[model samples]
Target: LPATVTIDQPAVLTASAAGDDVTCYNAANGTITVSSPTGGSGEFEFRINGGTWQEGLVFSNLAPDTYTIDIRDKNNPLCIVTLPETVTIDQPAVLSASAAGDDVTCFNAANGKITVSSPTGGSGEYEFRINGGTWQEGLVFSNLAPDTYTIDIRDKNTPACIVTLPGTVTIDQPAVLSASAAGDDVTCYNAANGKITVSSPTGGSGEYEFRINGGT
Candidate 1:
């Protein structure tokens, strides 16, 4: 029986004929169906990594590594072979943004800034935008008003895809003064008399003070 096997990636193996002069090669992860030449009683032995030969079908779960296999016929002791090969597996490309996580909360503030970083060690240019506005490289924003903003980050290498991050900003009004200070510490000017009157209230200090433009 003669059979051909297909494997994943690249690897090597050896096949030899035993009694019935049956040979096999390239028995990879693919299918390996054997057929007797005369359709008569024939048996073959298959071994991997120089281990004991198994009298059955062999399937390979090829990982990101290499392997070796040997096949022989049991009926013929003169049939023996050895094969060596190498396999290669490439890594997948990945791009990600580290700026936004699960949630983004903000307090009372007029302006805000957010920074975006790349985790994959690939060094390349990047662009960032808010609410689908103009894109800016380096993923840096400044003087952003208080509101909910949708951010988009894109890698220059792969412009077709973009990463998005949502953020929020808030602003609060300033506090105001309510009541006046104690008098005569507080005085009023009388334009008719061309004079200022300072009246000291009861249980208050008698000290007199004057100021122009809120200055002494």
Candidate 2:
């Protein structure tokens, strides 16, 4: 007498993946997570870009790029389930910002302005800010207080690509003017020998002028 036997094979391996892009400019925090895995031999292990296999279903700390994810059965190592769509991790564009500005002419003038050169190395219209204040579309910032400031620029296409310009904005003003005067008393009244001299005029751009009788 002969006995009949039957064999069973695991279903075809299949899976799907979802991913997230880097939150900040040039960041490496992108992630890819495997989900909806089906038709494998046993408990699943996952890997990306053919890296070492692990039981974890999520791959994190990945840079911005395209990736291939593979899911395999722990029971049958040869059965590898590839997600239908490859994972694509992306990041905000790298933004390079630089700026130069005009210093306030006088103390407390508050009329200083910043001129941000058309930003390079990023996409879309640029927005500007001062010291991380509210964002705006204008490149020139006017009526700024007399102090050191930083320009915050962002890409309209990618808000996450914000950058503080490398060059610091210094809206400054010269200190108020101060001076002392000395006069020589003439031996004779209204003598032509009488002389008044202004000494060591400090502050106010180091330039000074004396007005006799308040005359310009």
Candidate 3:
């Protein structure tokens, strides 16, 4: 008579993965398939961020953030491995702007101007728009018309981030004109070159051209 002994081999698990690396687009969305524990000794379980374990090894629709994934054998929970990764999602840039100069009283008066300083959080490139018109380069808006206007600003890098200031650029109406002479309104006719002097115009640039008796 002979005695025979049988030995059972310990179970070994193995996993493999091949795909696009995690990024702002992919968002660490991928899968890991286990090919060990032959003969279907047990099923695969997975978890993320220390959450409740779930069946399967596929992850998707993840947002921008850090994540910790662990895969284990359902039959032997102790047999597990953790994979740490981070996902980044691009953020829209920010913009800040300030204005300079003041309202003008006449068309020839100094026009108001706006200048955009260094951006706070977003890209430095900036653009300006007037009356919701076409976008233009640079931060300064000069030689503007003499009327209420809407000023819009945005980050060139991300147009979605924008700010609008209503009636920001305004030019006051032209001031009335008046003329005065050094002496009385009437002058001696045929007098030796009657002296005529004009005073500075009010509420205007002080420059003026007047016609006497409908003549130059």
Candidate 4:
């Protein structure tokens, strides 16, 4: 008769995720690549979010959320490893815009201005545009024409989060001025007191003033 003996060893595994913690709008996709297992000889298997085990060393097309990566040795089911890693996804930014300045004022005067309120979201500066024009810093729009305009706001860190708003500005011309004098140029100086009358100025309201020799 021959004697038989059995020996067993535990399995060990380690893995590292590729890329940063948060997936920005223009950043690369999140992924996890597992290294070869140690202390055992068996095929490697992986599973994400507690899903079915897959035959591969790398996982792709992952979203922003907490994930559970399970690694096990097919030869020895008891020898397994589990890792919990969180994948973060940035949220879209919210932007608000407002219009200011005179709407109905004197002609050739500065038109209404458009301003953008502070936005909430990722860090970095913000860009603005008016009437589908070029993008620029600051949220102010000056010397705008008296017409409707389109406003746009976007984050410098990410281009995916852009906000659009509709706006309008109006301007009016100043009133015209005209005056006439009702009196004869040649009047008998010493003959019966000469009479002179002044007509009210045109396009003027509130109060009227008559003066001679630039005096009030």
- Collision count for each candidate, in order: 9, 0, 1, 0
TM-score winner between 1 and 3, please give it: 3
What order do you get sorting by TM-score, best first? 2, 4, 3, 1
User: How far is 204's C-alpha from truth in model 3 (Å)?
Assistant: 2.3
- The sequence of per-residue lDDT tens digits that candidate 4 reaches over residues 13-110 is 65544423333443335566555544446676777767778767677655555566777676766666775454343333345555443442433445
Which candidate model has the greater lDDT, 3 or 4? Answer: 4
Instruction: Candidate 2: give the clashing pairs.
Output: none
lDDT value for candidate 3?
Answer: 0.56
Lowest lDDT block of 10, candidate 1: 18-27
Question: How many residue pairs of model 1 clash at the backbone?
Answer: 9
Q: Model 2, stretches more than 4 Å misplaced?
A: 1-5, 96-100, 107-110, 115-149, 153-162, 172-216
Q: Model 3 Cα displacement at 55 (Å)?
A: 12
Error of 3 at 143 (Å): 2.3
lDDT per model vs. reference: 0.44, 0.80, 0.56, 0.59
> Of the candidates shown, which would achieve the greatest TM-score relative to the real structure?
2
On a 0 to 1 TM-score scale, where does candidate 3 land against the true structure?
Answer: 0.49
**Residue by residue across 90-191, what tens digits does model 2's lDDT show?**
765666666787888777788889888757655657788899788988788888878888888788766777777776878878898878889988889777
- Measured with C-alpha atoms, the lDDT of residue 36 in candidate 4 is 50
- State candidate 2's TM-score: 0.62
Tens digit of per-residue lDDT, candidate 1, span 25-137: 11122323222222112455665556567775443332222335455656654465443332232222334456642222223334455556663421355677777888887
